[model samples]
Target: MSKSATIYRMVMDGHICPWGLKSLHVLRSNGFAVDDRWLATRSETDAFKEQHGVTTTPQVFIDGQRIGGHDDLLRYLGKPVRDPEALTYAPVVAIFAMAAFMALAAHWVVAGTLFSVLAAEWFIAFSMCLLALQKLRDVESFATQFLGYDLLAQRWVPYARLYPWLEGLAGVLMIAGALHWLSVPVALFIGSIGAVSVFYAVYIQKRELKCACVGGNSNVPLGFVSLTENLMMIAMALWMVAKPQLL
Candidate 1:
């Protein structure tokens, strides 16, 4: 036998309760025949709330038992609740994903081919620019968080402030394919410093800290992702230095 559920929600001109619609959809999708009841006016909604002893719309009932609102329905349906404050790799993943996609697009436009060493160069360059932009968004916050584990930043506070600008400059120069003399040195120096700092902070000291790689306000952890980002910079710097001789 198909189960049945009652969903009471607001449905007026220019004022449809979205949660109520979602509740009805969930019930229907879950093999339940939904008894959709609409509160068509302010008084109707108010009276419905008062009569049901509830304060909100989009209330659901299963087997004559109240299932509350959207969140309550989710809980009853066994869905995981996502907390906004939770730590995640989403920021770093987005940075790398977008950088790689942009690099490929640039490569295809300029060279007319997806296969080239320049693609890798562009990827690293775009990654640096994007990452630096995140940091530059809130330099003070980034520097404060960076100083917690970065050896150079802790020793010389001003370096923390300068790091994002330096990175941004290097990225721009690399992207423009100009002034390798300046950009290579900057990339090499900062990449080396970052690699050493991340290594000691994560491996040796074994401290669990937030990574300022994306920005000071980010929730990325100080671990493999941070390490890989620095390594990529170092490799790019080395390639830029050697590309002339190789050609």
Candidate 2:
């Protein structure tokens, strides 16, 4: 077999190891065969350790040369490391699209049809919230596996819960406003809350913190996309505040 075709051994300790699992998946995705026999056994680990003087699991060896961990393997595979700046435009586009869609829907559709739009918005917001919560959970799992710590995991649950609930409430308020029973103030309130959340995400990203907005899927640093999203939400709030009749 060719060198690249040779089955490589990856030694991993726990199933919860993100780096190991990610590396294994990436390797396999890149067409490298990984030998799972080296996962979490003293005998397998000891043999590799004696040969390479490595004490940790997630050891990668190719033709008997130690290749270190995930980062190293990623480098070896020549995959472009994630760059936050590169992803800035995507959020901006998404926000603009959302704003345009909502505006068109509100304008073209009468008040009677608003309920259907509100329902769609409710489902979307709920879905986004669920995705965010799931991402937060994955982040917790990742932190625990890598750092042997669960501090963020404990704190994230409560803080994260508020977002979905607020989003769902906003959807409800939109529906109520559409029914002409509630004033524009309710829709404004909901939009304001969303704007605040997006702005805060922007602030966090500006400070170089990773955004947990969409959860683990968000690799892009919060910047223009977040800011734009916030501004759009605020604009929507203002529109709703100004025109309760449209709702």
Candidate 3:
């Protein structure tokens, strides 16, 4: 004889009937067809209670297997019951550091102190820019290693090292003020570049790509954290450009 298809059984008092109804809705939503006949108390099967040792209403059985009660069902749905508030200390630190540096730059400019504080700001900004570009280099290096491709061996690609070189050069120009009018544009350009890099990192994570950012310390999903950091950096760069008197 062919074995009968196992029917799901649920029992609930009127007070807890809504939970069963909601579970039925979810079952239907997930494309599982359920017979409500098993829900009727008058004709319900005692076979389930005898086999599974269930002594409670709101008990559930699927395919002859006990699935537990209402609370257990909700827990099985994988919905987040609680989430911790996110922290943002890194971005906060970057903002305060930039603000302090700018204040010192402003003081030096006002006092007509030639080439001390201004040079310091230039060097600091340059260091930050280089660090950001280094992140890009690390990404490229990782891709090559993972893909096992000799990118430099192919002349058509030629390793694409020019972009980082240009970034470093831009840092130099920001320091030298090659064209006094170009300082703002350079700062804006550098800021724009960093913003794009950070955003691209976020985009990759959203697409479920493994992040090569910060050498594997950035395994966390991209969200408000990356966005805030990028925005802060862009703001700092713009502030430096618009008010050159504050470096």
Q: Give me the candidate number with maximum lDDT.
A: 1
lDDT of each residue in 1-247, candidate 3, tens digit only = 2222223445445433565666566556645555553545523646655656776545554556555665555565554432333432443345346645664675477666535545555644555454345446565563332122122323334333333443445556655656535544544554465455445545553433332222223343444443453454455356566665654
Candidate lDDT scores, in order, read 0.92, 0.49, 0.47
- Each model's TM-score, in the order given? 0.78, 0.49, 0.33
Model 3 vs. true fold: TM? 0.33
Pairs in clash, predicted candidate 1: 142-216
What TM-score should be assigned to candidate 2?
Answer: 0.49
* Candidate 2 lDDT by residue in tens digits, 71-155: 7777877877665445454543454456446644664565645445444444343333343344445664323321211122344
Better candidate by lDDT, 1 or 3:
1
Ranking by lDDT: 1, 2, 3
- What's the number of clashes in each of the models? 1, 0, 1
Tens digit of per-residue lDDT, candidate 1, span 12-124: 99989888888888888889998899999999999998999999988999999998998898899998666666778999999999999999999999999986899989999
TM-score of 1: 0.78
> What's the CA error at residue 146 for candidate 3, in Å?
13
Question: Distance from true position, residue 234, model 1, in Å?
Answer: 1.1
> Candidate 3: where is the Cα deviation over 4 Å?
1-139, 142-160, 175-183, 193-205, 208-233, 244-247
Cα-lDDT of candidate 3: 0.47
